[model samples]
Target: MFSRFLVFLLFSCRSLAFEDTYVIGAGDTIQISVYGEKELSIDSLNINSSGKFEYPYLGELSALNKTPEQLKAEITQGLLGDYIISPKVRVSVVEFRNVYVNGEVKKPGGYEYQPGLTVDKAIALAGGFTDRASRSKVYIAQNGSDDNKNKVKLSEKVLPGDIIVIEQSFF
Candidate 1:
């Protein structure tokens, strides 16, 4: 039983890491640094709408659906020998994708996405909805999805670049 519990714990941690870590998306800003390569380092870079971005020597690489660790490995592999004899690359999301909150919220605007942020937490960040807000019919429109927006429960995980709206109750 103890051994089984330990295995479960290990797997759970790994699962949480992937679920919580920010996936690179359009509009997210990344900071990249290559050890020993000053010219290749950048403080901030935007992932364009196409999920691709330009890098020195690398030209353009798609960053969508990838994590920072994955991007770092990609950059390091691409720069090896051609750009640097031994390249150690690091990539970090300086600014994650925004979650837009509109309608019935005190502050209806975009807020920075945080790891493990849920729909309820986002609504809290927007000042906990208005007096006439309907908690049950909270709408979420995912990025890249069209006409597929649907109502979600409070505990639903809000991904980056999602638009949330709190419908006003007809009380």
Candidate 2:
């Protein structure tokens, strides 16, 4: 029984680990900068539905399935090897994909996700919960691989593209 409990604890901790990298998604805005290359810096470039961006000097580049760091490295290499010498590149996400919040909230709709958003914060952004909201039972549907599916009873951390459903309180 003790060994079983230990195993459960380990698994629980592992499941709570947040993903270190953000997958480029549609509607996200990215900022690309090349050190000392003011003409090449692009700010607030929207990621199209195809996850591609029209980067300066680089033409079109696919950002989907790539992390910000990875994208930065790729852009740097492309510029240095082909265009500029010793290009220093940096990439940052200015906006994330919208997340949907529905059921029992005062305003049920899509909300923009900020860094480190929690379920409670999301509810507040939707103008708080209605009187009939079941605060104890909140459901979240995350978009990603099958292994990412979670049916959290009361999760604080909420990711982009997550669908949050608040049931009606029976009381």
Candidate 3:
């Protein structure tokens, strides 16, 4: 039916925009659960500054740039022999990393990153822009890299670890 086709189209478009596979990064908090093993489940584990985490049976595991599903697979594989038989492992991000907002914002600092966050929302979290802030001079440095800095608008989507700078306006 036309209605069914329209519903499918809508869902497909939504999925395209959704970040289904989020990469793990430093400062992110993760939770790992094994279906039947209480001791092996990690309620909450923060990825260290080096983007690595120590697991009981897995020893040191690098989580940087790996998706939660990928990490789950690694853990499941590591525990298959000695730790658990057929472990139904689940890994999820408990908290995302923070994004920094600096310059002309009143309360400029790092704020927790969330999905669908934009420059406008980040500025709001930083107590909005100062009176002298330049609305047209917003810039973003991805992952704190100045080399990647570029001019952006208020509607620009903010990524984790990004640095947003609001220049001072004079005129």
Candidate 4:
């Protein structure tokens, strides 16, 4: 049992790193840094509803569905030559999109997403399950996808912008 628990713990930690490969989307805030160029750096830059943000020179660059490194590359390429001979661009996600919890949760609403967020933790943030909440009927609908709602367990990791629904228990 101890070994099983240890494996589970390691798996959970490893799964949490999925955010590193997370696709940038609307409602996510990102930070862009250019080495030794304070004026070119931006902090807490929120991606607008259109999934685009205005950079210093690369006006209105799109960020939707792009990884941080991809955006960094775009910035670096854009700033090279005319803007800067050697642009050291760095892009990092400062804030992930909110995870929404609704249905049978006590305080159903959207909550800020954390790196290691799981179904259980997300429910806790929404004030936990109510009396009518059905633990077995929990479902998740990933943000920005056409996939149908999928059943999820308490231990399942919740990604940023995921919508969690706790169905009512008839019992």
lDDT of 1: 0.86
Provide the lowest-lDDT 10-residue window in model 2: 12-21
Q: Put down candidate 2 lDDT per residue, 24-107, tens digits, no spaces.
A: 777778898888999999877888778876777778899876778889888988898678979988888888888788889999
Off by over 4 Å in 4: 1-19, 144-147
Write model 1 residue lDDT over 1-171, tens digit each, in one string: 999999999889975685446578888998999877789999988888798878899998888888888888889999888778898888888887899988899999999988678999999999998999998889999973648798899999988889998899998
User: All models: lDDT?
Assistant: 0.86, 0.80, 0.89, 0.89
Off by over 4 Å in 3: 1-19
TM-score, predicted candidate 4 vs. hidden true structure:
0.85
The TM-score values for the models, in the order shown, are: 0.81, 0.79, 0.85, 0.85
Q: Mark the regions of model 1 whose C-alpha exceeds 4 Å error after superposition.
A: 1-16, 19-21, 144-146
Question: C-alpha displacement of 70 in model 4, angstroms?
Answer: 0.5
TM-score pick, better of 2 and 4: 4
lDDT of 1 at 143: 73
Measured with C-alpha atoms, the lDDT of residue 19 in candidate 1 is 41
State each model's C-alpha RMSD to the native. 4.4, 8.2, 3.5, 4.8
- Candidate whose lDDT is highest: 3
Consecutive 10-residue window with the lowest summed lDDT within model 4: 12-21
